[model samples]
Target: MNTPKENTYTCLIVEDEPISQEILEVYIQDCPQLLLKGVCNDAIEANTILLNQKIDLLFLDINMPKLNGIEWLKSLDEVPEVIFTTAYPEYAVEGFDLNALDYLLKPFSFNRFLKAVNKFTGLQKNLAISDLSSDLTITVKSNKKTYLMKTSELNFIESDGDYLKLYRDEDCIVIHETLKAFQSKLPQNNFLRVHRSFIINLKKIDYLEGNQVCIANQMIPVAVSYREGLKELL
Candidate 1:
């Protein structure tokens, strides 16, 4: 049995769509570990909320009328963990460039939302633990079987249609999970989102070419928009 921790994380939602905002709000209400700070329609309004409050997490939408999510995050010198939500798949790489904790597509289901929240919970637990260097493990369920994954074993992850493919040294496992969910479980230090559809383990990267990253024998393409930040990571 798992007991809810006493620490409550405050989250702010910066979404223009009313329906999406409501859905996210409901999910926040269902989670005992999260508290809704506020919801804003655009980056301008979100900046106001940030100025007047203490936020632990930000649920931001990529496209907006003015000061898009990516641009707004880039302007911020001090930012909380960000989870980007968008309808366009192309923005995925740009979202990672901002160092978002996760990227959620619009019209996401409750189960998928739960997975992202679970990742947030796991991260919180790891932060609370005194031992930071301990070998961390997480479980991903595929075909109704739970697979234990060590952080060090992960090389990179790629998006496959609606599913996500997890890559290890020589093994590749496809799971019916979103990249957003797994992103939350990973530590920010070792894992970096180098492309729209890919997240690479920084430690596993051997070298980087013009728009590709070499990890073991795999050469992953790095989106042009994300190349600058990916270069900084390398």
Candidate 2:
């Protein structure tokens, strides 16, 4: 099973709307590494929280009274990793210009939010590999039951919307996890993410037909961009 991350990031939310603030608060709570410091209705309130607490990350909104997010962000001397959560797409360029970690357009689904947080957590994992490194067993939960499977087992993984289908020798396990998140947990040397939506074990490949890989009567397509790197690995 993958090791749990213990380096929690203290997060502060600066948003004007009550509904948006509540939504962001819940999302932050869902991530085990994120501890919500406080939620502010405006930049003025958030400044107080920043002064009183050491915030590792900030979920700042674009539109607010008196001072906007961009203006407030520009004012800071030393800023934390900021993820802009806003209803406007026009502010995305300005947000990234300030070196924002990510820009989340309003009305984003939970899966979308999870994907963004995954990027943040992935960076943390790289910074502290000794603490975050996993065992070869991958744990997946389906219908409230968790299953642990070894990474070395014969298999390939396919994306299925907000989930993935893990095909082993004789059994296929369906788990509620995106392919991207699942790909990050696997051993990089043993598993290859051949496409955006699929990852396969290199040892299980029977043969390559054109851009497709035949493994245990299954055909997995390899994207043009990944084929050259895959050939080099083989």
**Backbone clash count, each prediction separately:** 1, 0
Alpha-carbon runs more than 4 Å astray in model 1: 1-5, 131-234
Tell me the spans in candidate 2 whose CA falls farther than 4 Å from its real position. 1-5, 129-234
Global Cα RMSD, each model:
15.6, 15.1
TM-score of 1: 0.54
Q: Scored by CA lDDT, what does every candidate get?
A: 0.85, 0.84
TM-score of every candidate relative to the true structure? 0.54, 0.52
Tens-place lDDT per residue, model 1, 1-234, is 133346888888999999999999998889888888788999999999898887888989988988888999999878988888889989998888877778888888878887877777788778877346434798988888889988779999999888999999778888987788888888777888877799988889898777898998889998888888877766
Q: Highest TM-score: which candidate? A: 1
Error of 1 at 84 (Å): 0.8
lDDT of 2 by residue, 98-185 (tens): 9888999998878888888878877767867733443377788887889888887747999989888899997898888878788888
Q: Model 2: clashing residue pairs?
A: none
